[model samples]
Target chain A: MAVREGLLALLHEGPRHGYQLKTEFEAATGGVWPLNVGQVYTTLDRLERDGLVGVSDNEGQKVYSITVDGVSALGAWWEAAPVDEPPPRDELMLKVLMAIERSTERGDAHAMSVITHQRTVLHSMLQSKRRARSVATTSLAARLVTDALVVRAEADLRWLDLCEAQLNGTPTRKARS
Target chain B: MNDPVLELVDVVKTFGKGSTEVRALNGVDLAVSPAEFVAVMGPSGCGKSTLLHLAGGLEDVSSGRVRVAGRDIGDLDLASRAALRRTDVGYVFQRLNLLPSLTALENVALPLKLEGVGRREASARSLDALAAVGVTEQLSRYPDDFSGGQQQRIAIARAIVVERALILADEPSGALDTMTGDSVIELLSSLPGRFGTAIVLVTHEPRFASWADRVVFMRDGVVVDQTASTVPVSAAGAAT
Candidate 1:
């Protein structure tokens, strides 16, 4: 879905060849998602076949451009909020929730251990991201991506704390020694 | 079991006497264990600052007990309390209070140096603390030569440089932009694990509060509610 929509959006700017679209997509997303050249051309072919794009002659090379329908489609894509019809099936969430359910059935603390272990991992990830953010001087995009990761890691840690608090009821407040 | 790094039991603080008295805190009870981070959130005039002052031994409680590193603060004499604060507790404020003439390394080393630590040892430890807060390259830069974020890092370095068991921060990120503030909070969150120090952070921002292990809400000089954030781990990843 990203490649198809990304190709449409890139073509919206101007006519770009297939390889250019791939490079531009990679750059826009900070290279987090690498695009296959074959996949890009296949998507372009489908778009052209569906009247969403058109192949035009540019000095002797074939360039892809958005059609009227493609412009309308891109506009629609921009206007609509991304759909989560299937409710994103994240592997980590599935694993945690499943672990919680299983631990509850078994009357064990395995779920709590999972949450704690995950918290430690996320904390280290956050530290590395912070280190990266401090040293990253060349690319604003890279810095922004690292910042996002740090925020996410912090949130994940908060959630793990929440999971422990819920599983154990109120957190015990120990008296001073 | 190990002792809590910070504790307050039925703590009360009054600013004046009789009719003119203002009750800044009333019978507040709290504890922070080593490696724990607790955030206190409230509106203005809600005794959050008073709680921090008591924990850090900045001000004496009118009644009730305040303990740090398992020692009762009220029982300690002035010199002893000052020594406790210098050697066992760390405090960070909205205003960094870094000396303009000192470089980041020197500013961080000042606390240990004041405690009679040798210059070489203090400088080495200060550099380690700065690196922990991700401020290595700016060690030689003075406060005026750095940005708000860098200055705050220096302040944090100074706070933890003495290997203090407890850290009391009062809106330490209050002066920075949202992004920079989040970075500061992230840095603070990492400290408890890295240094095995307990942290009591006072802030009005919920976003900042969410980073703590527990969020305590104070109102009218008393704790009203406490809640652990229920944000799902995957949801956090998806939020960005």
Candidate 2:
């Protein structure tokens, strides 16, 4: 989806061939997402089929440019909010819940230990991401990527803290190791 | 590498005796080299605050050495420790960072004045400290007139005013909102480079700790781990 919108964003500037689109997209993203030339052409085909792009001949090679409809579509995409995939990739939370259930039966403190260990790991990850951001001064895209990771890790750490707080109710908390 | 401005070697601190004894810190070792920023992070009752207290000489260590500017604090008497704290160490707390009645310049100059410097010279040095923290406007304005973030900056200015070898701040960002707290932490992260003073910050928030050159984690009165950030700082050394 982003590739389609990204191609439109590039074509919004002017006409470009498939390889040009691929290189420009890679450079624009600071090479964080290297797009194959084939992928670029495939996305362009879908965009052209959807009337978001118009292809023409520029000295034998095909050139793709944004159409009147493409500009409007890109504008809407820019303004629209990003969506998170619901109920997806929540493996950590599931593991914690299952661990709590078993730890309750076994009378062990393993669940809290899991939370503590994850907190340290996430904090360490954040330190690395923050370090990356500090040194990525030359590339805005690289810096932004680290910024995203830092915040996401911070959010996970907050959730772990919340789990710790909700624990310690005697029945569930002091399940001795 | 520069000599550590502050070093805690196998330090221990306990409150009360025998039956009711509370071991606040049990065998923690840390070193803060010149112009380095170290953050101590842990949950409550983890001895983070106790460690800062010992580092600033506000409290004595029980069984180990705390050396500030190369002198072991355990060997110093009360008067000598007071003088050392006055001259070599600075402290910043979460609240009451500045006196309400004193103007910004006076707040910054308070430490120098207590050190027996002349009023004119103290004021001159205080002005530079204020400027270093980017507090140039309204030197005559009291702390209440400034915003919370500005107030924190002034408090930091006071801490750094006297070229103290080290500054120990305990939860300095604990009271502010997220954005304001972030700005304050940013200011602290810049201090080592601009002032040549080592900083040991005690905070539970990982966000703030991420800015430090190194972070020491405490658990149940023990130093569980110390990790160094990849951010470049002077005298980068291995964490123990």
Candidate 3:
């Protein structure tokens, strides 16, 4: 979805062929999100089909440009916050849910064990990220990414603690393992 | 292994007596080596503070032994315990406990002064301790004049000024904002490597506790779990 809108935003700057859009997108995001030429062309084809982009030929290459409607769409995209839409399918959450169901059916303690294992793994990851954050030589982009990961991992650990508390019928407190 | 700077063997601590008895700690065993940072984590009323108090010689154990620097605290007289506290153990509280009337340098120097160190030598050591925590410029400022982070750093400097082997911190970062709290935790975590100070910290926040070399979890007056931290304590040749 970001790539789709990102291509539009790139074309809005100036008319660019497929290859140019791919290169510019990667460059703009500090190479964090690499784009493939085929994917770019496919997205451009869809945008043109929807009348959000116009195609022109220059020097035997097709140049894509954002249409008036595309500009309005980009404006709306900029103004509106990104919605989760389908509410991202987090694999860890799915796995934990399945583990809980299976543990209950088998009368086992596998669910808590699974949570504990994941928390240890996440805790180790959090420690490394924290170390990276503390290093003065780390880049701002790397630092920001680590910070986000740390926050997410902390939140996930808290959720796992909450799940354990609920399963054991213990009162939930603000501070947790 | 070399003797741990702090050790508790089957330690039990109780409050009141008879029918109103409350066991704050029951059969707790812990050992912390010099330069090792250990975090004690648990829910409220779970004996975390009691364990810290016992280790710091602030409270008497009802049974078993509490040792610091290879000496059993229970065998020490009141004056000997006080002298040991002055020279071998430091406590950092959640409130910092800085004297409002004293400057940062003076507050940090107070411990050494109480130990009967000369004024000049104590002040010089206090300045070095303050500089170690990056608070060199705030030496003359009173606790009220410094930011929460600065005040905590000064408190840390005070804790380490006597060059104590064991530093007991009870929620040292509890009163600061998350960022400041994290920096404070980072400072405390670094001390084990920088000064060979064994730290036993009690905190409910796992985020802060992650800074330790090991974490001990308590529940119902006993240690329920223990885990080693992933972050390796710098290889300073200190024994585990």
Candidate 4:
């Protein structure tokens, strides 16, 4: 969804070749997600077919521009809110639930160990993020990326703590030294 | 490993008599080395605070030994234990840390003052501590005039003023908002590297506790488990 809208957003600025959009996307995302030039052209073809973009020959090369419809689409994307309410089904939730279920079935304490292990990982991640925060000195995008990782890591640890509290009925496994 | 600045050997703390007794800490053993960061976490009534108090020699241990900077606090006299607490220990509570009557400089300098250091030398040392925590302005202002986050920073400056071997902080960021709380934890995580002092932070929030090098979890007056940050779990098994 973002890739499609991101292309339209880039065109909304002005006309650009496929390579320009590729580089711009990389720069904006801090090079976190790499985009293929072929895929960009394929998506551009679809946009042209849908009347969302116009192609032109500029300096013996093809350039893409956002049409009126594309502008409206980009505007709509801005107004549309993302869904985050119901706590989307994610891998961590699945792992924890299964670990607890397995522990109960086998009369063993597996979940707390899982929780502790996950917490330790999150803590180490946080430490690295702390270092990154200090080093990500100049660019706002890079700084925000690090901040996002930090908060996400923090949230995951809190969820693990919640799981530990809910499973307190089970005896805590004596942690390994 | 460097020698532990604080060590609790088979520490047990209890309150009241037989029928009305409540065992706060049950045979907990922990050692925090110099320049290490340790956090204690648990449910309510889990003796996290008691563990912290015993570490700082704020409360007497019912049995076993408590050592600070390699000296046995239990073996020392009352006056001597108090002196140890003053000279070798620093505390940061959730709130009410600073004296309302004193300026920020005086509050940080109070620890050195209590050691009978001269006014000139104490003020100079206090300024350095304040600078270390990134506080240079408003030294003349009282604690009441500053925001909660600023007050917490100043409180931290006081804790490190004398370069104490151990700092016991009990939910230092409990009262601040998310961003402010995060900055406080960030400042604390920098302590071990900046000052070479050991830190024992007692907090229920894993977000704040995640900054520590090791985290200890307690239950029913017992140290149930602990996790160290050295070996992070595979990033492939991430979170929600």
Model 4's CAPRI class is acceptable
Which candidate, 1 or 3, would have the higher lDDT against the true structure? 3
Tens digit of per-residue lDDT, candidate 1, span A64-145: 9999999999899888998644423245567678878887777676776676556545544544455566656746666677
TM-score for candidate 3, residues paired by index: 0.81
**lDDT value for candidate 4?**
0.83
- For residues B122-167, what per-residue lDDT tens digits would candidate 1 score against the true structure? 9899988888888979578789998898889889999999888988
Each model's DockQ score: 0.05, 0.38, 0.32, 0.35
Candidate 1 Cα misplacement greater than 4 A, ranges: A1-66, A72-177, B229-240
Candidate 3 per-residue C-alpha lDDT over A1-177 given as tens digits, one digit per residue, 9 for 90 to 100: 678898989999989989989888876764567888899999999999999999999989998999999999999999888864542326779878998888777767787678766666666666666666676474565556666667777788788777766766632222232
**Worst 10 contiguous positions by lDDT, candidate 2 chain A:** A168-177
Best by DockQ: 2
Q: Candidate 2: which stretches are off by over 4 Å?
A: A9-31, A59-61, A67-118, A139-142, A163-177, B1-3, B14-22, B177-179, B229-239
The candidate 1 chain A region of ten consecutive residues with least summed lDDT is A168-177
Where is model 4 more than 4 Å wrong at Cα?
A: A83-89, A169-177, B229-240
Instruction: Summarize candidate 2's per-residue lDDT along B99-214 as a digit string, tens digits.
Output: 99999999999989988999999988999998888899999998989988899999999998888889998888999987688788888888888888888999988888888877
Clashing pairs in 2: none
Worst 10 residues of 1 chain B by lDDT: B231-240
At residue A22, candidate 4 shows an lDDT of 94
